[model samples]
Structure formats: C-alpha cells, structure tokens
Target: MYTPRTPRIVAARRLQRRKDRDQSGRFLAEGPQAVREALAAGVVLELFGTGSALDRYPELVAQAPEVSPVTDDALNALAETVHPQGLVAVCEQVDVPIGKALVKQPRLVAVVAEIRDPGNAGTVLRTADAAGADAVIFAGDAVDPYNGKCVRASAGSLFHVDVVRSPLTIIDLLQDSGLQVLATSGAGEDDVDSLLDGGLLDRPTAWLFGSEAHGLPEAMLAAADRRVRVPIYGAAESLNLAAAAAVCLYASARAQR
Candidate 1:
C-alpha cells in the first residue's frame, strides 16, 4: 500500500492548492460521489483509496483508469476534510472557454461574479444544475471552481454542467450570446416574481450573481438588461447568496418550462 511518504502520494497532496492544480490542469475530487462523477465524466486520471474504501466501492474502482491502494495517512494527506472519506481522485480541470460554453444558445445561465466563498459558489453550481441551467460562468475574480470545498459542495454537479472561468471576456461573451443579462441586487427596480408575471423570465436570460458582501459590480449592474430583487416575505434581513441564487434560478426554471 502507498504510504504518505510515497512519491506519487506526495505529488497528489499538492493538488490541494489552487496554484498547483492550475499548473497541472488537475484537481483532487474526494469522497465516493465526487470520484464516481469524475469517473463517469472521463476526467479521473488516478484514484487513491484505502483498502476498506476500495472494497466498499468495487464498482467505482472497476471503472477507474488507475487505482492506488493507499494508507489512511496517505489518503488524509490528499484530502481536505477533517474526517477523510478514504478516497480521493486526481481529475482533469473541467472548465471550458466562455465562447464555447455560450455557443449553444443557452436559454438559462448563471454567471457567478467575484464570489469569494467556495462553498457558496459550488452550491450555486449545484442549484444551476438542478434548475437545468445551460452553463455556469465564473467571472471576474470569482472563486476557483476546483477549490476542494467548492468541489465537495458541488455534490457531483461539477461534472454534469459546462463550467467557464472567464476573467475578462464575460461581458463581451454574454453580449454575443444574444441572451438578456439580469443582475440580482437588493435595490433593483423589478422583483423576481414581477419578472415572472410579466413573462420576462421566458426569454433567453443569463443571471449575474455577485459577491456576498458587496453584491454585483456597478458596471455589471449597469450593463444588465434589468436588475432584479428576490422579494422578502419573512422578517429576515436578506437571503444568503446560495439561497438567493436558488430562488432566482428556480424562478426562471419554472417560467421557462
């Protein structure tokens, strides 16, 4: 069994960092679900699992291209979780070019702009996938989608959707996509339900979600076809990013279908 000191094990540990992952064009997917999805997506290059884990997931092991039996210490070194799940897989980065992601003329899309929290970003990705969004764009200093926390929070949805990391060309690309851009903000003129009632959500649309602390950039909000706010029914001050995104995405999903 491979130990923590093994050369390959040591190398796999570096994938925990974004810099190394970007340089190598690979990231670590931990737990059975993430690994299984990565395998199904044909992105898993190598899988590392403890003896018990391998036995527990024979079907997944059978599908992996390369499997390494590892000690608990080795698995722990590659995993980000406090309680390691005994499995981790090195998978290829799944992001595509912004132009390519928008080429299909998607009716519904989610643009995650400058969201610092990986968990929130991943949850948005999962929500998008659940709502049947065509693609998710990480634009303008957004959290890396390959972040371990983000990967885990995605719950295997990362491999199911077209993801794009576009630092600069998002606005230009969105304009070219022929989809109306809508920015979610607190001080928007239109409420989400109002948009739905007005039949605006039926159009091909891309929703722009910004940082949790600051909301969307002024430029993005200005460029959007409309600024939308999710109405607050309860006494809560505001909805968190993931919750707000779910509300907006599902609204579009309900309208479009």
Candidate 2:
C-alpha cells in the first residue's frame, strides 16, 4: 500500500487546491457514488482506495483504468470530508465549450451566475439534471463546477449533464443560444404560475440564478427576456439558491414536456 508520502499520493493531494485542479485539468471525486459515476462517465484517470475499500467496491476497482492501493493515512490526506470515505478518484475535467453544450438545441438550460458556494452550485447542478435540463452554464464569477464540495453535492450528477464554464458574458451567450432567458428574482414582473398560464414557459428557455446573498446582478436581470419570481404561499421569507433553482427548472421542464 502506498504511504502518504508516496510520490503519486503527494501529487494527488495537490488536487485539493483549485489552482492545481485547473493546472492539471483534473479533480478528485470521493466516496463510492462519485467513483461509480466517474467510472461510468469514462473520466477516471486514477482510482485510489484502501484495501478494504477496494475489496468492498470490487466492480468499481475492476472497471478503473488505473488503480492504486493506498494506506489509510494516504486516503485521509486526499479526502476533503470530515469523515473521509475510503475511495477517491482522480477524474478529468468534464466541462465543455458553451457551443458544444448547446449544440443539442437544448430546450431547458440552467445558467448559474456569481454563486460562490460550492455546495449550492452542486445541488443546483444535481437538480438541473433531475429536472432533465439539457445543459448547465456556469457564467461569470460562479463557483467552479469541479470544486470538490460542488462535485460531492452533485451526488454524481456532475457526470450526467453537459456542463459549461463560459468565457463569454452570460448575456452574450444567452443571446447566441436563441433560448428565452428568464432571471429569477424576488422583484420581478412574472411569477412561475403566470408564465405557465400564459404558455411562455413552453418555449425553449434558460433560467438564470444568482448568488444567495445578492441575487442576480442588475445588468443580467435587465438583459434577460423576463424576470421571474417563485410565489411563496406561506410566510417563509424565501428559498435558498438551490431550492429556487429546483422550482424554476422543474417548472420549465414541466412546461416544455
């Protein structure tokens, strides 16, 4: 078994940093679920686990293109979670160009902009996949989709959808896609029900979501074809970024189908 100080182990540990991840074009996915998904996606570059972990997940280990047996200490060094799962996989980055992501003529897309939280970003990605969105675009200043927390939060959905880390502005990209852009906001002209009732949601659409604290930028909101709000029937103040995204994406999903 490889020790924590092993050369390969040391190199894998560096992936914990975004700079290393970006430079290497790879990231770590921990636990069996992520390992399984990464394997299915054919993105796994190397799989590392304790002997017990490898034995427990015989199929995954067998399927991996490359495998390394590591000491518990090495596993600990690689994992980001408080309670480290026995397995971690180094997987190539799955993000694609904006044009390729939208090449399928996506009917439903999720545009994530300026969301700094990795967990929320991953949840939104997971929700978008669940809602059958064709693609997800991480626009200006959004959390990196490959961040370990985001990858974990996605619960393997990161491998299930087309992900785009765009260099162009959200407005420019949205305009080029020809999909109606709907910005989710507390202050908005249209509510989910109104859009549904009016058949506006039937069109190919992209839902734009912003940060939990600040919401969408003024410029993005103005650029959107419509600003939409999710109506709260009860006395709750508001939903968090993930919850709101789930609501909006599903609404569009239902309408388009």
RMSD of each: 0.9, 1.0
* Candidate of highest lDDT: 1
Model 2, position 140: C-alpha lDDT score = 87
Error of 1 at 75 (Å): 0.6
Candidate 2 has what TM-score? 0.98
Tens digit of per-residue lDDT, candidate 1, span 1-257: 99999999999899888899989999999999999899999999999999999999999999999999999888988899999889999999999987787788889999999999999999999999999998999988989999999999999999989999887346756877788888999999999999999998988889999988999989888888899999999899899999999999999999999
Model 1 ranges off by over 4 Å: none
In model 2, the runs with Cα more than 4 Å from the true position are none
Model 2, 1-257: lDDT tens per residue?
89999999999999989999999999999999999999999999999999999989999999999999999999999999999879999999999888787778889899898889999999999999999998888988888898999999999999999999974266766667779999999989899999988888988899999998999988889989999999999999999999999989988888988
